[model samples]
Target: MKIAFTAPMKPLDDPVPSGDRTMGRLIVQALELGGHEVRVASRFRTWVKEGGDAAILTRETEGLSEADRITREWEAEGYRPDVFLTYHLYHKAPDWIGPALADRFNLPYAIIEASRAPKRQTGPWALGFRAADDALARADVVGALHHADAECLGAVLQRDRLKILLPFLDTLPFETAADLVIKHHKAPKLLAAGMMREGDKTRSYEVLADALSRCMDLDWSLTVIGDGPNRAYVESLFPPERTSFLGALPPEQMPQHYAAHDLFVWPAIREAFGFVFLEAQASGLGVVAGSTFGVPDIVQDGKTGLLAPEGDAEAFAAHLRALIPDPARIEQLGEEAARHIRFRHTLEMGCARLNAFLETALDNRWQRSTAPRRPHQSSGQPL
Candidate 1:
């Protein structure tokens, strides 16, 4: 199967990277791993943070031109993709290219991580929001990352088209790293990594600071990693002597960081599922994160990690206080966390699930004459 991949929020080669960009690149690789030939549909980002009437019209025209250009190029090559797969389709990042190009090529179109909200039909981003809703409605199938998203997508996509897929991470890096489960700890060393932005990021940081301060009676120190616009503000929330900031580390370096730390603690407010939780568990570290959207999917409550109520600093602090002095419990949870991620949340597992869903989505429409589409390159490798 030849898949035309596109992400409206950002390109696979985006410079200022985030979890979304990483997910986009990973999805393409996962499809390829499933023995599908994939190509980038367009690099032009159709994401509009917020725009009024005039700006909306301008972006609409630009999206059409970009889609037309890709259509012409693909037509000239006499190549028609079996399907078009768009990643991260939300109002803030709509599928401005994939839906249009898929319609032009008369191909099946699918989306991953698509969300819809009717209330946004009239806002500064009303145009983009409508476009996203239409794109999801047109999809032959949509892979939802969370139950919340699946419920939301129900308004736009049919039951047959909605596939619920949990947010996942590539666990190979952490799986191959040296284990830190046996590390000695007189005072547990906590670790957290997240960009320090104004909205959710800063709020999470502030919540974490409050939680940690309340746990001062416990024996623990901390290390924070990540850099962003509000570094100074975030750093000020913590005691300078107790916290060591490592700034931002590359994704490749995260496994080692996870392995070096005793506990992974962070308050993820309304997160789809923090990618770091999976990474930390894969490295055999117990986690303490706020109980929010999609988090319970990644962090098994009693088995792998502890989850405090969404915004309860006292509960979050108590969780830390309970775990800080208990090495036996930490090791027990860490072992379980690692095993959980290996069996359920790895990239290979996610790819296998997606491959099966895509085949189902193809339904009876699939035929061997689509054979020239190429041999099934993937042998259904184990994740």
Candidate 2:
């Protein structure tokens, strides 16, 4: 199947450290691997970052044409993808462009990792929400990674149309360092990765600090693997010497860090779907996450890793303390986590499910439109 994929926040090839970008690239790779054609719709910002690549799309051509241009370009080429898939769409590029493109091209629309917060509805933002509502209403499939998102939007959209497609990690690269990774293991080390945002205070740096204070009582070291605005604040909360804020490492360099750590700890509150959990799990790290969002869907309590109540520092610290001493259990959980991801949450699995959904949606649409039905007169009687 040919797919027109767009991501408003970041393009697949954009040189930005983000979960959305990571997932976008993985999706593209997975679809290609699954024997499908995928074309990424790059935005001006992405092209600008690439220097000469900016020439492919002119500023005026891009700015002047608007959403209709996408359909026109596709039609001009005499090619229309079976589906228009968008990722991390908010009011920005998603609401306006997606519906227009879908309506113009007459194709199934699918959105991945979408969100709707009612409080955010006001002024110009209100229009975005309305557009999101329309898109959701007309969408053939709305892939939700987190349960909260599904619950929030389920009231508006058909429940059957919403499928839980958890963001997965690509673990093929991590296979090379099997021996070296195991070698770095000593006392239990916990790892947390991804850029931090302070407004939500969701990364749970405060919880990490408390965990460390209690971790000294237990035999373990905590390693935070990403950087953001919350870095300095979080780092300051912990002993500067003990906690390592390695900023953001290259994607290739990440597996080594994961390998060095024995466990993964993410205390963020209300996550959409923590892809880091999948990554950590894929790297064979015992998982620890806050019990909110789709995290429960990923981190099976006592099976893959432990779950702490959202923002509960003492409880999080306690769980880590208990798990640190038992290497056998830790190894067991890590193995299970990896196995679970390989079986259920791999990019391959996600793409296959997506493909199946598209096929079903198209078939259903055809059936609905074509099936024989009784004609009703203006008086409401069947003719």
Span of ten consecutive residues with least summed lDDT in model 2: 374-383
How far off is residue 183 in model 2, in Å? 3.9
Candidate with the greatest lDDT versus the true structure: 1
Which runs of model 2 end up more than 4 angstroms from their true locations?
Answer: 42-65, 91-93, 121-124, 184-186, 201-203, 368-383
For residues 1-383, write the lDDT of model 1, one tens digit per residue.
Answer: 77788887788999886878877887877778888899998887877766776776777788889999998898799777777888887777777788788666656677888877778788787887888888876777889877877888787666878888876678877877734334766888899989988889898999999999988777788999999999999999998889999999888888888888888999998677888888899999899999887788789998899999987888999888899889888888889999999898878887898787677545512331253343232322111
Tens-place lDDT per residue, model 2, 110-206, is 7877777776466445544555676677677787777778787777777667777777767776545434664445677778775766754435777
Task: Give the Cα-based TM-score of candidate 1 against the true structure.
Answer: 0.92
Compared with the true structure, all predictions reach lDDT values of 0.81, 0.69
Worst 10 residues of 1 by lDDT: 374-383
Instruction: Give the TM-score of each candidate.
Output: 0.92, 0.85
